[model samples]
Target: MPRAKDLDTVAPDDFLNSTLKSPLPPRPIKKPQNKKIKHLHQSSNGKSHSAQFRQNVYGILGKTKHPFSSFLVKPKVFNFRERDTDEEIILVLRRHWITNLTWILITLSMIIAPILLTTVPLLESFPPAYQFISIIFWYLITFIYSFEQLLSWYFNVYIITDERVIDIDFNNLLSKNFSEAKISMIQDVTSTIIGVSQTFFNFGNIQIQTAAEVPEITFEKVPNPEIIIKVLGQLRQEEELENIEGRVK
Candidate 1:
């Protein structure tokens, strides 16, 4: 805008002629094309970084999935009998799969026991019917033992949820022992990987000391004991923080 002194210096006729003409068409702004291209590239790079970060997070969350896995994290299709609706399971574990080797070896031996025994004259002294019945009985016993062990290994599970720690054990087909302790009650966690096999397989036992009815709960031969301990520690911290917040209110 012209200042008062500059306007006073201009001729009235010139000022009138300038205002009277159709206002010059406003000049179109010239955008810097290179700056726009650079801005677009930066935005694309940010989006890619954000997408990669989300993918990594999902990979961490869905770390385990195999149904027979001894150690699982954030399982998608598992639920327990006594679990609360709001409680979320963070970890599900059983004895390391390698622990089943003892029974597996024994079962394999039992399967071939009859063949090995054929080299002996033990059945020669008996009648044909007696020998048949005896062999049948031996195999029956072996089958029963194998079945029982399979059930035991499959059913005995230790679970860690956002709210509690649970141990489920089946001593027999008809009997199950269920033990649980709140995350808030857990005081200390101790892990032991004693023998060569345990160390080699990276599996061990973990003892949890809690203020719940069961003072100490032990998970025998579970995989990733240190990771379990770390998760428990995190849960305990969260529980304590929640308690403090509750008390403040």
Candidate 2:
């Protein structure tokens, strides 16, 4: 009986030991924890850093629509004058009618003189060679007149602005004279409509006296000299007002 009792005790102990040696419930097969990912973008202030960056970029780029108004540095009070809201101004030119008439008269003479000389009974007795030479001369004169007309039209330009005046004088399309004077430096302005032709045609010359090194500025053969003078006087008055108000620079 003692031996059987001891054997039963041993078997129970071996079973308990084998059970303990066996793996425990696989420890719930714990998986490695995934690391949390951090975002690269973050706010500097309460506002988004990206939004602030875009705002800065916009200010640097400036307004695209109104180029004239953008990024203008305000002038000092003493230097300030009437500002030119419009950078460019009315640019007048010599009337096309005057040039056309001059060319037309020359062309008509060239055409009519030769025909009259050839067709007239008194001139028909002239030598054929003389007539041919005369015809060629007349055509040559016509060509010269046409060339001059083209050159005059091509090179004539006048520019007027609140800030300054520009006169581009081109003689024969090859030699050119460009003169400019500031509106503020203008001391005296004169307009002359001398002859009956000038008065009838409403065109004349305007002379401007300046304080600059160049003593005088003349606008020759400009249409409506009186109107130009008036416009200039108005601009000068505005400039004076602005100077008094400390708005011009």
Candidate 3:
């Protein structure tokens, strides 16, 4: 008999015996998907409700979610900082969408009225130079009106932070009113939702009475007034507790 070959030197068999089995194939590893990345992908379609929801919660400043925007819509961060180290924005509030309806409609009318005026025979009676000047004047007026309305809305903001609540009022481009109340100074929080639109839209005003110099801070036409009241109450309680603990320490 030939000497037995070493086990390692045996020829590999393509077909195994009926009683034998090949080793199981290695298991595949799975990758964890990031929620933010998945949200961005979903937003590509622009119809994802969940993506919009996430944007509202996470802030509108793209990946950083900083809550500030160049556009006048849902600004998450006002870029206003009360404290550098510990200040964290809990919510940024703006007037309800319905509140802008008047200005938006007026803007539309301003845009459309000029075009409509061109159809009038009165415009045809004017000289070419006069007509051109008139058009320019109308457009300039429209621009000024639109700019003023947008600035009013854009600058009017209410911000709630861990330490304080702020109300910024823009009377005009040159005039601004800023008020703040510390969380510890909050004495009473209440909200009012009146009118069919306010009720239907689920938005109203939040009135915060505080022990601060301002005494009263009102966040007008803000969305979800009840929620704001609840959050304010909770924050006030937390602040009081912190003050007590600090005194003890």
Candidate 4:
């Protein structure tokens, strides 16, 4: 037999028998993955772009997605003045962007008309200063029109909460009509998608018949009308269940 010193220098494989199996490599320790939530939770104290607004929520609403989205599920930043402390907002909706195309096209035409015409035939008769003022006034009016249209789109909203349905008609900065009805009061919900654009964009009108002070609430040119109806239906069912349980008590 070889000396112990010689055996130690030899490769382990040279003396290996089947019984001396190599210890299995330690099992890899996997790093845990963090799963992201798709919707905002009220308790999470979410925030939006506005500093005053503490409702911030984002779900794949990246560069490709509009920040002022037409549809948001479990929105965290929206809280109407009348919102109850415990009321949880389920959805926030604005009119589909396609609805603004007509005004946007008009605005674009107005912007380019002066550039294309170079000089207005009417302005030719006026002094240079007067002509400049006229041009400025035209551009100012164009800006106002576009700004108003954007503000209307941004402020006007339809909201769905656990307990109620809300509609806000933001007519202007200072003037808005706020309307709401309890989810329990909803009697019927109907959705209508009309026109090629509406159909293609999957946006339409939602007509809600309710027993509240406002008999009917219509969401015009809103995206995902069918989904809104379905959500309402589910809420109605939940409300009915709660009523039944309350009656039993």
TM-score of each: 0.72, 0.54, 0.67, 0.71
Residue-level lDDT for 24 in candidate 3: 71
Q: What lDDT tens digits, residue by residue, belong to model 2 across residues 203-223?
A: 787899988766788877677
| Candidate that would win on lDDT | 1
Model 2 weakest 10-residue run by lDDT: 69-78
Compared with the true structure, what per-residue lDDT tens digits does model 1 show for residues 21-67? 85878899997679888878766765565455334433544588587
Looking at model 1, the pairs that clash are: none
Full candidate order by TM-score, most accurate first: 1, 4, 3, 2
Task: Rank all candidate structures by their lDDT, best first, as comma-separated numbers.
Answer: 1, 4, 3, 2
Off by over 4 Å in 3: 1-77, 81-84, 247-249
Q: Count the backbone clashes (under 3 Å) in each candidate.
A: 0, 8, 3, 7
* lDDT of each residue in 188-217, candidate 3, tens digit only: 888898999989988887788999999999
Stretches of candidate 2 off by over 4 Å are: 1-86, 120-137, 241-249
**Better candidate by lDDT, 1 or 4:** 1
For candidate 4, give the lDDT.
Answer: 0.76
Error of 3 at 230 (Å): 1.2
Report the alpha-carbon TM-score of model 2 versus the true structure: 0.54
CA-RMSD of model 2: 19.8
